[model samples]
Target chain A: MARIDLVDLAHSYDGGNADPSSFALKPTSMTWRQGGAYALLGPSGCGKTTLLNIISGIVKPSRGKVLFDGRDVMALTTQQRNIAQVFQFPVIYDTMTVGENLAFPLKNRGVGRAEIDARVHEIAKLLDLVPQLDRKASRLTADAKQKISLGRGLVRADVAAVLFDEPLTVIDPALKWELRSKLKVLHRALDLTMIYVTHDQTEALTFADTVVVMHEGSVVQTGTPEELFLRPDHTFVGYFIGSPGMNVLPAEVEGRQARIAGHELSLARSYGGLPPGARIEVGIRPEFVSLAAAAPGLLAARIERIDDLGRSRFAHVRVGDLKIAARVPRGLSLGGNEAGLIFEPAHIHVYADQRRVEGAA
Target chain B: MEKIPNQKAWLLVLPVFAIVAFSAVIPLMTVVNYSVQDTFGNNKFFWNGVGWYQELLDPSTELGGRFFASLWRNLAFSGAVLAIQIPLGIIVALAMPREGWGVAFSLVVLALPLLIPWNVVGTIWQIFGRSDIGLMGWGLNRLGFDYNYVANPIDAWLTIIIMDVWHWSSLVALLCYAGLKSIPEAYYQAASIDGASRWAVFTAIQLPKMRHVLVIAILLRFMDSFMIYTEPFVVTGGGPGNSTTFLSIELVKLALGQFDLGKAAAMSIVYMLIIIIVCWVFFTVMTNAGADRKGAGGER
Candidate 1:
């Protein structure tokens, strides 16, 4: 296992002369500790896959150094780098049985036949593929095929890391959870550095120890699931992590007060020296904001709709022209369309130009 | 749900039957009729029974000797053609550009030979292999090798084989190229990540992926080479010593050259049966091998 470092890594499918803004992967630097489970989370064309490919050495970055264990590996091919990658679709040798598929990496590396067999069986057992050891990999279900793909990745003991490029995309819905948890289990048992690239938040949130949220080719935030939900560094992170997402509204900010739609909300922290002419906004999670009966101090809103999500209800409220999501308190009777929103002072975050501002508490 | 028996469904299949009857069945029947009868120049025929078949099957008889010799020649020719073409085609396919403007240029150039008419291919090679006028023959002789396709049997065989390979190797290559194109980029990436070498990638991934197409290429090449008559016949006209007389050439000689209608019809029928049977056996074996693996996996 190796700690992977991306030292100002950047890439553009077009050559070096291309404009910096058009790069598929914008300049970024981050380090992943050995044996850490990390997920690169982003929507399609957000450069997550490009980043993953760069890590795996499938695509060479146009700039920057990739260091493994503090050694620059720019000239190393993927095989020389000793990384394993499972693709979005299951990629197994159709002519080979599951056992042979698992043994492929070892065999290619000229590992002893006995050791290859042992490793194959061990990986197969871990993947619950012992019964399918001799069966053709091509004829297996998509989930099983993905499992075989995973098994192949895990068979080699000396691999620096195993990279997954949305490996569970083709799995059945019911099987996705099973395979996902299986991956989590494998990560624990094998103690290999696993970097999973996916757009699905649940997959990222559940599988990763630290989730790196990306937007438009740049990493917006890198934090644990709770941290991402509680304190998103960027507006994209806040809007992407939570179910209803953090409700962001165009606002005017001064000191600890944020005025939205001509109404004021107090802040727990004092904000000073705000960037001039920046697009200022206030973000609050729906879980923190509560719907109440129209009160004098509360911000007035028109309840557009209430979504009953079993454990809780969120009222989609319109405050002036701005729409906001506020939690509907249990055991409260609503008499009319008009309601008031109470934004929890501690939960409110100030943003300028789509990036969170750190205020003095 | 109750079943509805509609007899009109069979009527929908009438066009297929009519087409098959006119295109295949009636012509085949005419051959079958001719195979069992003796016919003269006047078209007056008499039942010859299996007398012609018996003579054709017995190697001691003149008809049997000629048939066996030509059949062996056809088999050898097909074997040689397959042995050379399959690997050459695969190599060419591999060497082809995977992308860019070069891909279009390569594809067009590769298809040029296959687009030529069979007789035209024959004529081109016939002159091309001439010691007096052709570049290849003139060049070879000038380089101190006595090469004359018109006079030497080995030279004649080599020329025809080379001609056949040139004319048809592109078809196999094109088919293999198509097979290679269908493989997702992920497979190669996965193989590379697996630490597979070039040979390992070819054997473990590419070769297996191209199995279906390779089977088609082999079958087509085998059938076409086995029944080949046009090119070699044009080039050598069965040669100075009947050296290039393949089965089709022999059959044509018997039917048109010698006017032996009974023997030629029987020979053509036998040739058709051999092709059908060989193709059936080959197809069955390949498909079953694929099926066996699927069956062994068992459903989830």
Candidate 2:
């Protein structure tokens, strides 16, 4: 396995140097470590597939160098790079039996017959496809075909890496979890570097040790799932990672004090000499916002609606013109139309110009 | 509770039944009637029973020998056409442009011959194969090959085969091209990533996916070539001592040229049965091969 490095990579579909609006993938640099399970997470058209293709050498980047283990591989074809890619749709030779499908890559590389047979059998057993080894691949269910796709990649022992581009999209919902866990088991058992591209946050968070979140053709944050959940690097990350997302309120900041809707609030960190025209906001997760009795620094809001969510409840409240969602524990009784909302000091984050400010405790 | 059968569905099907009766059954019955009896010019018919059928089946008789010879010729012509056209068509289809303005232009050009009527195609080839005025014949003669389709049996056969190829190869090519286009880009991409060579990709992916279309092309070409008449009739009139006389030409010569009604009727029935049996065999073999590959899932 080899570590993949993308240096100043960018892609424009129109064949000209692209402006921000036209570029399919914005210029950026990142490195994927060997034997690491990583996910490129984003919505549709967010360039996750483009980035995956670039890494796999399927698409030549318009401007960049791709290095495999510090060796420049920009001129190498996909075959020369020796990377295996599984597509969104399962692609198998319909005429071939499952055994032959798994053996195809090895055979293409001119591996010996006995070795090819051995590898095919090993992979088939790992995928629980031993019984289907003699059956034609065209006759299988979609998930089974996808398993053959995965098996073909795994059958090659000398591949640099295995890349998946939304490979679970065609699988049934109940089978998705089983295949996902099977992927994780294979990754651990084989110790191959795997890069999965998907638009589903749950798939990314559960599958990858390090998840890279992209928004609008650029990466917004790359971190462990816990870090992303706790401290999002950009406002998009905060709004994208959680169920109800974070509540952001417009604010004006000066030195150690911030004012929101004419109420002065104490700051967790100092913002000395802030830019003159920079828009500022306070971001807090709904889970961290608490309901409290009247207290100093607590903001009063009118509770518009309360939704019971079995183990917890969501209190939709309005403070002046701003709407906020606060997740409160079940059985917490509150009678009035108005309640004091308290922001947990350690959980509160500040953003300036849509990026998290540094020194926010 | 026992449910009453709905008999009114027959009324709904009556129109189709009437159409088939008028179009197929009545004419076939007339042929059968002619096959079993002897008829003169004044509507006087006498029972012939199986006399004409026995005469047609007996190889010692002149008509039986001619029928067998013509049948063999028809089979050979169809076999040669299929052997040449199927591979040539696939190659042409593969060479066709995949996208952009070139695709539309190439498709229209390839489809030009198919849009022409059968008589027009015959007349065009008839004039085009003449030694005095035709390009191919004049060019070959100028090159010192002594080519004349009217006088030489081999030259006449060659001219007819070439004309048939030119007229119908495009149909096969168009069908194959459609099949090739339906393949997803992902299959090729995956093949490339697997380090498959060009020939491997063709055999493994392209050929397997085009199997159904190829079956259709084969069946159409086989039936059409076996019953071919107009072009050869126009070009050579089954000339050079009946060297190129196929089953259809021989049947027409019997029915219309000589007015031998009973023998012609028997030959027509035999010809129809042969076409049906051959087509059924081809369809069954190809479909069974496909089903074997696709029936594995049902086995579970």
Number of residue pairs clashing in candidate 1, backbone atoms closer than 3 angstroms, sequence gap of 3 or more or interchain: 0
Model 2 agreement with the true structure over B202-270: per-residue lDDT tens digits:
999999999999999999999999999888888888888899999989999999999989999999888
Per-residue CA lDDT of candidate 1, range B52-75, in tens? 999999999999999999999889
Candidate 2 interface RMSD to the true structure: 3.8
User: Clashing pairs in model 1?
Assistant: none
TM-score of chain B of 1: 0.95
Please tell me which predicted candidate would have the highest DockQ against the true structure.
Answer: 1
DockQ of 1: 0.57
Q: Each candidate's DockQ score against the native complex?
A: 0.57, 0.53
Residue A62 displacement (Å), model 1: 1.0
Interface RMSD of each: 3.5, 3.8
**Deviating ranges (above 4 Å) for candidate 2:** A261-265, A291-297, A302-312, A336-339, B1-11, B292-300
